[model samples]
Target: AQSVTQLDSQVPVFEEAPVELRCNYSSSVSVYLFWYVQYPNQGLQLLLKYLSGSTLVKGINGFEAEFNKSQTSFHLRKPSVHISDTAEYFCAVSEEKTSYDKVIFGPGTSLSVIP
Candidate 1:
Protein backbone atom coordinates (compact mmCIF):
# COMPACT_ATOMS: atom_id res chain seq x y z
CA ALA A 1 0.00 0.00 0.00
CA GLN A 2 1.01 3.60 -0.63
CA SER A 3 0.06 6.62 1.43
CA VAL A 4 1.06 10.29 1.43
CA THR A 5 1.03 12.78 4.29
CA GLN A 6 1.26 16.56 4.02
CA LEU A 7 2.55 18.00 7.27
CA ASP A 8 0.95 21.44 6.93
CA SER A 9 -2.72 22.13 6.52
CA GLN A 10 -2.13 25.75 5.65
CA VAL A 11 0.77 28.07 4.97
CA PRO A 12 0.27 31.84 5.04
CA VAL A 13 2.90 34.02 3.46
CA PHE A 14 3.40 37.57 2.27
CA GLU A 15 3.73 38.26 -1.40
CA GLU A 16 7.28 37.97 -2.76
CA ALA A 17 8.33 35.82 0.21
CA PRO A 18 9.42 32.20 0.21
CA VAL A 19 7.42 29.10 1.15
CA GLU A 20 7.87 25.39 1.63
CA LEU A 21 5.36 22.59 1.90
CA ARG A 22 6.40 19.27 3.36
CA CYS A 23 5.23 15.84 2.35
CA ASN A 24 5.97 12.25 3.37
CA TYR A 25 4.96 8.95 1.92
CA SER A 26 4.96 5.29 2.91
CA SER A 27 5.02 2.50 0.37
CA SER A 28 6.28 -1.04 0.13
CA VAL A 29 7.05 -0.74 -3.54
CA SER A 30 8.54 1.79 -5.91
CA VAL A 31 6.48 4.96 -6.17
CA TYR A 32 6.04 8.02 -8.35
CA LEU A 33 5.91 11.42 -6.67
CA PHE A 34 3.86 14.37 -7.82
CA TRP A 35 2.76 17.81 -6.68
CA TYR A 36 -0.38 19.47 -7.96
CA VAL A 37 -1.83 22.94 -7.58
CA GLN A 38 -5.49 23.85 -7.68
CA TYR A 39 -7.03 27.26 -7.96
CA PRO A 40 -10.34 28.08 -6.32
CA ASN A 41 -13.08 25.86 -7.72
CA GLN A 42 -10.72 24.54 -10.36
CA GLY A 43 -9.24 21.19 -11.21
CA LEU A 44 -5.79 20.20 -10.10
CA GLN A 45 -2.85 21.00 -12.38
CA LEU A 46 0.43 19.13 -12.39
CA LEU A 47 3.13 21.14 -10.76
CA LEU A 48 5.91 18.56 -10.88
CA LYS A 49 6.72 14.88 -10.83
CA TYR A 50 9.56 12.58 -9.81
CA LEU A 51 9.38 9.32 -11.65
CA SER A 52 12.92 8.01 -11.40
CA GLY A 53 16.35 9.47 -12.30
CA SER A 54 17.16 12.76 -10.58
CA THR A 55 15.97 13.56 -7.08
CA LEU A 56 15.51 17.26 -7.75
CA VAL A 57 12.61 18.23 -9.99
CA LYS A 58 11.46 21.69 -11.09
CA GLY A 59 7.95 22.69 -11.96
CA ILE A 60 5.94 25.58 -13.30
CA ASN A 61 5.83 29.00 -11.57
CA GLY A 62 9.31 28.56 -10.10
CA PHE A 63 8.26 25.72 -7.82
CA GLU A 64 10.53 22.77 -7.16
CA ALA A 65 10.90 19.72 -4.96
CA GLU A 66 13.42 17.12 -3.94
CA PHE A 67 12.77 13.44 -3.53
CA ASN A 68 14.54 11.83 -0.61
CA LYS A 69 14.54 8.10 -0.86
CA SER A 70 15.90 7.55 2.63
CA GLN A 71 13.21 9.69 4.23
CA THR A 72 10.45 8.91 1.75
CA SER A 73 9.68 12.57 1.49
CA PHE A 74 9.04 15.01 -1.38
CA HIS A 75 8.87 18.62 -0.26
CA LEU A 76 7.88 21.61 -2.38
CA ARG A 77 9.61 24.97 -2.21
CA LYS A 78 9.64 28.37 -3.86
CA PRO A 79 12.01 31.28 -3.32
CA SER A 80 9.50 34.04 -3.98
CA VAL A 81 5.76 33.84 -4.15
CA HIS A 82 3.04 36.08 -5.53
CA ILE A 83 -0.62 36.66 -4.65
CA SER A 84 -1.46 34.65 -7.75
CA ASP A 85 0.39 31.75 -6.19
CA THR A 86 -2.26 31.39 -3.52
CA ALA A 87 -3.86 28.04 -4.01
CA GLU A 88 -4.22 24.52 -2.67
CA TYR A 89 -1.25 22.19 -3.04
CA PHE A 90 -1.45 18.45 -2.99
CA CYS A 91 1.19 15.71 -2.81
CA ALA A 92 0.50 12.32 -4.25
CA VAL A 93 2.16 8.95 -4.84
CA SER A 94 1.46 5.91 -6.95
CA GLU A 95 3.05 2.51 -7.10
CA GLU A 96 5.47 1.85 -9.94
CA LYS A 97 4.26 -0.12 -12.98
CA THR A 98 0.69 0.44 -11.79
CA SER A 99 -1.87 2.44 -13.67
CA TYR A 100 -2.89 5.65 -11.95
CA ASP A 101 -6.55 4.84 -12.19
CA LYS A 102 -6.90 5.16 -8.43
CA VAL A 103 -4.51 7.83 -7.33
CA ILE A 104 -4.77 9.30 -3.82
CA PHE A 105 -4.34 12.89 -2.71
CA GLY A 106 -3.17 14.48 0.50
CA PRO A 107 -5.49 16.59 2.61
CA GLY A 108 -3.89 19.58 0.87
CA THR A 109 -2.00 22.61 2.12
CA SER A 110 -3.85 25.85 1.57
CA LEU A 111 -1.37 28.53 0.52
CA SER A 112 -2.58 32.04 1.24
CA VAL A 113 -0.51 34.84 -0.21
CA ILE A 114 -0.93 38.22 1.43
CA PRO A 115 -0.40 41.40 -0.51
Candidate 2:
Protein backbone atom coordinates (compact mmCIF):
# COMPACT_ATOMS: atom_id res chain seq x y z
CA ALA A 1 0.00 0.00 0.00
CA GLN A 2 1.06 3.59 -0.65
CA SER A 3 0.12 6.85 1.02
CA VAL A 4 1.00 10.49 0.39
CA THR A 5 0.94 13.50 2.71
CA GLN A 6 0.88 17.20 1.95
CA LEU A 7 1.69 18.93 5.25
CA ASP A 8 -0.01 22.21 4.47
CA SER A 9 -3.50 22.42 3.02
CA GLN A 10 -3.15 26.06 2.04
CA VAL A 11 -0.12 28.12 1.06
CA PRO A 12 -0.24 31.88 0.64
CA VAL A 13 2.64 33.64 -1.07
CA PHE A 14 3.37 36.99 -2.58
CA GLU A 15 3.57 37.23 -6.32
CA GLU A 16 7.03 36.60 -7.87
CA ALA A 17 8.26 35.06 -4.63
CA PRO A 18 9.89 31.68 -4.45
CA VAL A 19 7.63 28.93 -3.17
CA GLU A 20 7.92 25.30 -2.31
CA LEU A 21 5.11 22.81 -1.86
CA ARG A 22 6.13 19.93 0.32
CA CYS A 23 5.19 16.33 -0.46
CA ASN A 24 6.14 13.03 1.10
CA TYR A 25 5.21 9.48 0.29
CA SER A 26 5.49 6.08 1.91
CA SER A 27 5.60 2.84 0.00
CA SER A 28 7.26 -0.49 0.53
CA VAL A 29 7.88 -1.08 -3.15
CA SER A 30 9.63 1.27 -5.52
CA VAL A 31 7.26 3.74 -7.06
CA TYR A 32 6.99 6.58 -9.53
CA LEU A 33 6.50 10.10 -8.15
CA PHE A 34 4.45 12.80 -9.78
CA TRP A 35 3.18 16.33 -9.24
CA TYR A 36 -0.08 17.48 -10.73
CA VAL A 37 -1.76 20.85 -10.97
CA GLN A 38 -5.50 21.41 -11.06
CA TYR A 39 -7.13 24.72 -11.85
CA PRO A 40 -10.72 25.58 -11.23
CA ASN A 41 -13.08 23.69 -13.58
CA GLN A 42 -10.17 21.81 -15.07
CA GLY A 43 -8.72 18.34 -14.83
CA LEU A 44 -5.36 17.51 -13.31
CA GLN A 45 -2.30 18.24 -15.45
CA LEU A 46 1.04 16.58 -15.09
CA LEU A 47 3.51 18.98 -13.54
CA LEU A 48 6.49 16.66 -13.32
CA LYS A 49 7.45 13.03 -12.81
CA TYR A 50 10.25 10.80 -11.61
CA LEU A 51 10.05 7.50 -13.42
CA SER A 52 13.79 6.84 -13.31
CA GLY A 53 16.67 8.89 -14.54
CA SER A 54 17.86 12.14 -13.00
CA THR A 55 16.87 13.04 -9.49
CA LEU A 56 16.01 16.58 -10.51
CA VAL A 57 12.91 16.76 -12.68
CA LYS A 58 11.61 19.88 -14.34
CA GLY A 59 8.07 20.51 -15.46
CA ILE A 60 6.02 23.05 -17.32
CA ASN A 61 5.52 26.61 -16.02
CA GLY A 62 8.95 26.72 -14.39
CA PHE A 63 8.06 24.09 -11.78
CA GLU A 64 10.59 21.49 -10.70
CA ALA A 65 11.07 18.70 -8.15
CA GLU A 66 13.82 16.46 -6.88
CA PHE A 67 13.36 12.80 -6.18
CA ASN A 68 14.95 11.90 -2.84
CA LYS A 69 15.03 8.20 -2.35
CA SER A 70 16.48 8.18 1.14
CA GLN A 71 14.19 10.92 2.44
CA THR A 72 11.23 9.48 0.54
CA SER A 73 10.25 12.94 -0.53
CA PHE A 74 9.54 14.83 -3.77
CA HIS A 75 9.03 18.47 -2.94
CA LEU A 76 7.94 20.85 -5.70
CA ARG A 77 9.68 24.20 -6.01
CA LYS A 78 9.62 27.28 -8.18
CA PRO A 79 12.08 30.18 -8.03
CA SER A 80 9.41 32.73 -8.87
CA VAL A 81 5.65 32.42 -8.84
CA HIS A 82 3.01 34.17 -10.85
CA ILE A 83 -0.55 35.09 -9.96
CA SER A 84 -1.76 32.79 -12.70
CA ASP A 85 0.06 29.96 -10.97
CA THR A 86 -2.50 29.80 -8.21
CA ALA A 87 -4.05 26.37 -8.19
CA GLU A 88 -4.37 23.09 -6.31
CA TYR A 89 -1.28 20.92 -6.40
CA PHE A 90 -1.40 17.19 -5.82
CA CYS A 91 1.38 14.76 -5.02
CA ALA A 92 0.96 11.27 -6.34
CA VAL A 93 2.73 7.95 -6.41
CA SER A 94 2.18 4.52 -7.90
CA GLU A 95 4.04 1.26 -7.77
CA GLU A 96 6.45 0.95 -10.67
CA LYS A 97 5.46 -2.58 -11.49
CA THR A 98 1.72 -1.95 -11.24
CA SER A 99 -0.74 -0.12 -13.41
CA TYR A 100 -0.03 3.58 -13.84
CA ASP A 101 -3.69 4.34 -13.41
CA LYS A 102 -3.68 2.81 -9.95
CA VAL A 103 -2.13 5.85 -8.33
CA ILE A 104 -2.48 7.30 -4.84
CA PHE A 105 -2.92 11.05 -4.59
CA GLY A 106 -2.46 13.37 -1.66
CA PRO A 107 -5.20 15.58 -0.35
CA GLY A 108 -3.76 18.62 -2.16
CA THR A 109 -2.16 21.99 -1.47
CA SER A 110 -4.04 25.04 -2.53
CA LEU A 111 -1.60 27.76 -3.58
CA SER A 112 -2.76 31.34 -3.37
CA VAL A 113 -0.56 33.98 -4.95
CA ILE A 114 -1.06 37.53 -3.76
CA PRO A 115 -0.01 40.44 -5.86
| lDDT tens per residue, model 1, 6-46 | 98999999999999999999987788989999999999999
TM-score (all chains, Cα) for each model: 0.95, 0.96
Model 1 lDDT-worst window of ten = 96-105
Top-TM-score structure, candidate number: 2
Off by over 4 Å in 1: 98-100
Clashing pairs in 2: none
As for candidate 1, its clashing pairs are none
Clashes of each: 0, 0
Model 2 misplacement above 4 A = 98-101
lDDT of 2 by residue, 3-84 (tens): 9999999999999999999999998889999999999999999999999989999999999999999999999999999999
**CA RMSD per model (angstroms):** 1.2, 1.1
TM-score of 1: 0.95
Tell me, by lDDT, which candidate is best.
2
